[model samples]
Target: MTTEKLFKVNGVELWAETFGDAADPAVLLIHGASASMLWWETAFCAKLAARGRYVIRYDQRDTGRSTTYPVGEPPYAMSDLAADAIGLLDALGVERAHVVAQSMSGGTGLHLGVDHASRVASLTFVSTTTGDDELPPPSDDFPRFSTPDFGDSAAVEEYVVRAIEAESAGVFDEAAARVLVRSDIARATNFEASLTNHYAMKFDGPQGGGFGELTMPVLVVHGSRDPVFPLAHGQALRDAVPGGKLVVIEGAGHGIPEPLWEPFLAALVEQTDAR
Candidate 1:
């Protein structure tokens, strides 16, 4: 079964959707910056849920149908986002959950594994870095598209499609991406706000608290060809945490492409199951 609801978390309403049985082990899916729960496509969540896991995906403060902040002004900090995660879990009566975080949310997951270790069963960080200053910068070849006019829906959709194309390795599906882009724009209270506010969001302190602070199982999934954070970042993360594992998606880029779902899902399942 599937369910959707609005949760009052951290004094803000966050929109959440869940798939599979409530009785099953819960796996929380946190998308990257400026993205909504739609990024974790319904089909992907369903497939993960089919593996005897309850999957939960939600929109952060300034994304999707959830609460949005004024353009270029987000009041919350990175730590506040972590608190929001805990509040969401409390509201759901979930004592513990396996967290699958992508890109920006990876730092959030790391914080949870450190400050709120009791609440996180396991952590899976995808396409993210360890925040180690020594790491290499993003790939020079990785393309970036310019933002489109917010008032023009077609322009916005085209921008999203082009961005995804540049981010994917070689298996990008323009049709599927367009569908998601349309939904994202249509449901957002202010799509432009997310784009602007995320950059403005504050950080309570340095992200990725001491690696020694983490005691739970940790998994780092990165594409071999990751444009941002590069494969070295993933390797460093796995090496930092005790018993942390790494899974490299061959020929993949910044995000999880459709073709690499099998290995990605398997690695995720293995990490959670190990716990």
Candidate 2:
């Protein structure tokens, strides 16, 4: 079962949902840029909860039912996003949590692990790159996606479906993607803002030290066929953090598709369980 609520953090309202027992170990799921908690499907959260984890998935600022900024003028920086996570934990009465982040939010996780190390138990980064200039650029085959007409719900849903097909290696589910996108558009506070504002935010590096300063257990999850960051990025990310581990999803692209959920879950549970 999932419990949804609103919390006042950093003078803005954030909508969030939680699964399983509050007394269990907590896992905070941060979605990629231009995404809401909907990307972290309910079934996935339920499975994690069944493994004795308290799962939390939320709408970041300008996404889902949370507060929204104007379409092209987001007022907060990326570090503010990291601070919002800490404020959320305080509101939930959780002293420490396992942090799981994907794409752009991976930097946010690094910030928490370095600057706010006391609040995080472990860090799991998915399909993201470390800000290393030496990393190879995105593959030439990377998807060239189109923007949606936000006023037309059908058009927006179709856009999402096309994006999923392009991003996944061979596990795109059109029906499921349509269903999820429809709900996402219908419930979002300002769907257009959610999709556009995140891209404009500036990222300030960790306030303390860098990834090498992280003392918590770090796990990197990447797809074998990821076009954006590629497997090499994941390898380098793991190498940067002390004692970091990498889990590559064979035949997967940038995101964790449904078929690969079990393996990803196993890896996540194992990482979070580490001392």
Candidate 3:
């Protein structure tokens, strides 16, 4: 069963959903840029929950039902975003959790492992980079698509489909993508603010310095065909983090398509079980 609720952390209201028994080991899923907890998908969450793990997925501040900032660069730093995750754990009385973070939010997971090590049982990074400037840049073919105006529903739908297709290498369900995009449009209060704030992590510089010090078990999963971050980023992350394991999904792109779900969940469960 899944339960949705709001958590007040650092004076901000974060919307989150919980799955499985509270007594089980916890796993916190952090979505990437311009996405909500919805990005984790119901089937994926349910699968993890069925594995006897407590699953928690939430919208970061300024997205979904969480607190929204005004349109502009956000005032908070990357560390503040990391603190929000810890704050959520505190609210739920969870001392430690296996952290599963995707794309840009992967930085947040690294921060937690470094700054608040005791709160994290393990770490899983997907389709993410170390934020180091020295790493190879994204593929030349990466889509630099622009976000359409929020009021234009048709344009937004097309944009969402294109974005997903670009990330998943045209391996996504069109109907599900449309439903998610429409729901996101309706739920978002300030789409621009959320997007801007989410991407602001780029300005914070590379967060790879402390990876070698994280003692927790770590898993790095990447798509062989990811145009956004690419496979090199995953390789670098696995190399940097001590005892980190890397899994490459052949023919997959940046987005976690249906084919990768089972393997990914097995890896997650294995890592969490190690804790």
Candidate 4:
């Protein structure tokens, strides 16, 4: 069974859901830019839980059911998002956990490993960048997608489906995509806050030498065809963290598709169990 609740951290209420036994080892999953915990997918969480892990997924401050500051730019820095992750762990009474972070949230994971190393058992960065100066930017061949009209539910759903299909072209599931989009629309209280979160990542400058401080095991997963961050991003992340392992999925893209779930779960389980 899964338990869903709101956790207050640093005066912000973050919406979270957990699966499996509380006594089991914990795995905290952090979603990407402008995404909520819904992005983690129910099946994936259940599978991870089945591996005897206490899986936890949560919405960031400006997204989903979490508290939002919609009137202006988010009042917190990227470090604050890192603190929120630790705060959630504290609230759940989990002294340490393996972190599975996606896209921009990888920044948060890096921060956790640096600023709060004692709380993280391991780090898994998925389709994300290290914000290092030496890495190449996104591919020029990558298409620029227009923003969707959030006020129109159909438009939002269609937009989400298109985006997911584009990112996970080989493994897109229409039914699952619809469900995730619907859930996000139903619970989104502040659209502007979500945009602000995107801006925070957009302007956040280079992060130098932080990854070198992580003493725990690190796993970097990226798709071979990912146009956003590209494979080089993952390679740079692995290079930055000492003894980090990289798992590149052939013919895959930015999103974790259905086809890669088994391999991804296996990698995650391995990292979590290693501790």
Candidate 5:
């Protein structure tokens, strides 16, 4: 069964969707930056739930069909985003839930693990960066595409074409690339502050309060081909947390839903069982 609901946190009405049985153990999946809960990948989430887990995916304030921050409002930090997780749990009446977060959203799980250990059953960080500082500089190959300097139609069109070609050569899927780039561009245009808020991981703080405090069984999953975040970030997370398991999915890139979906499900299942 599935249901869509709305709940408020910090004056923002967040949208959430729930899947599977309520009687089953709950697994909360948080998507990466600039992405909606759809980033969780429907197939993966559905298959996991079919294995007898209650899964929840939601918009993180400004993404997808969620509430928007008002103009002139102060920026939201990783901690504030963490609070939204807590609010979701409370609204759902889930005392403790396993957390599966990717990219920037990994910090949300970490924050909850640090501040409210009792509320979290386990954590899975995927395509995650350890710290913004330790990250290897952006891949040199992605020069014009990575830059935010695409100032016009011609530059933007060329940038999108290049990105698609890079994603897969010989196919040149301009239609697919246009859809993705357009969605991203629309998000940035509609909610500039929220986009800025999503990128503001600097608030993750020094050492991020240390993973030593997370007593729950933790899983760190990363892909070697992931460009946005370096593999070293996964290693750092594993090193910091006691008994943390790291799963390196081969050939998977920044997006976990595609090439890495199976391993992602397996790692999540193992971590949930351990927790």
Candidate 6:
């Protein structure tokens, strides 16, 4: 079924989609930079809902329909982003949740699970990293995306829309892709900028050390075909986190494609429900 839902965090009107029973054990789904809830495969979210788990996927501040950060307010850090996640959980009165994050959001989720274990029941790290040194440079075949010169807002949106529309799923059609990509970049600029500052502040500060503190079960999932963040990052996350299991998808890419949804969700649901 179609879903439209909203919540308030730090007095900001945060938007999200609710799937599954609200009363059931909750799974808080976080997206990567430049992504709203649009990145998730619909079938996967619905399947988790069907299995009696409350799947809450939200628009991080500055993305989707959520409220944007104020102009003069302090820029957001990785901690700030993690705080936003916690704020959402607190706002909903959710004591603990299964946290699933992909790409850049993986770092933020790692911060949360290690620092605030009370809030994370389990962690699913997908196409993600814990800021490890084991990450190799991107391969020659992969398109280098998100450089400092991504061009102006409109240009970046146009490029991203055109690029993602060409993906196999046909999910983000031309028109829909434009709206989602354009709006996401425009709204989330400040928060994303803040994230950049955070990156600079802690560049080489430490790598995934907090994983040693994470006691909860974690499932690290990645795609062999993913060009952006290769399978090595996944392996590193699994290694850093104690007892973490790595599940590699054969044909999957940077984004979780529909072809791998079954295995991804099965692995995700299994780990989330197991412990």
Tens-digit lDDT string for candidate 5 (1-275): 88888888776778888889878889999987756665565667788888889999988866766765543353677777888888998999998999888877887878888887788898888778767475585455643445334456556555655754553323344665566556655544334444444665446542336677788888899876666565777788898888988898877656553444677787777788624
RMSD of each: 1.5, 1.2, 1.9, 2.2, 3.9, 4.3
**Taking the tens digit of each residue's C-alpha lDDT, what string does model 1 give over 164-254?**
8878866689999999999999999999997778778985653555776688888889999887788999999889989988899998888
Model 4 agreement with the true structure over 117-225: per-residue lDDT tens digits = 8888999999998777877877776556777766776886787677777777466678888887878878888764664565654334224347877889999999998
For candidate 2, write residues 1-275 as lDDT tens digits.
67999999999999999999998899999999978999999999999999989999999999999999989999988889999999999999999999999989998999899999999999999999887898988778767777878778888878778877878867788889888888888889888898899998887898898889999889999999987787999999999999989999998898898899999999999987735
| TM-score, per-candidate, Cα-based | 0.96, 0.97, 0.94, 0.92, 0.82, 0.80
Write down the worst ten-residue block by lDDT for model 6: 197-206
Q: Rate the local accuracy (lDDT) of all candidates.
A: 0.87, 0.91, 0.85, 0.84, 0.72, 0.71
Model 3 is weakest, by summed lDDT over 10 consecutive residues, at 200-209
State the local distance difference test value for candidate 5. 0.72
**Best by the lDDT measure:** 2
- Which 10-residue span in candidate 1 carries the lowest summed lDDT? 203-212
Mind giving the per-residue lDDT tens digits that candidate 3 earns over 32-114? 88798888888899999999999999989878889888766667767788989999999999999999989988878888888
* Model 4 clashing residue pairs (backbone): none
| Decoy 4 TM-score against native | 0.92
What stretches of model 4 exceed 4 Å from their correct place? 201-209
Counted clashes in each candidate structure? 0, 0, 0, 0, 0, 0
What's the lDDT of the predicted structure labeled candidate 1? Answer: 0.87
Q: Model 2, stretches more than 4 Å misplaced?
A: none
Better of 2 and 4 by lDDT: 2
Give model 2 RMSD, 1 decimal. Answer: 1.2
Cα-based lDDT at residue 161, candidate 6: 63
Candidate 5 residue 129 Cα shift, in angstroms, is 1.8
Model 3 reaches what TM-score against the true structure?
0.94
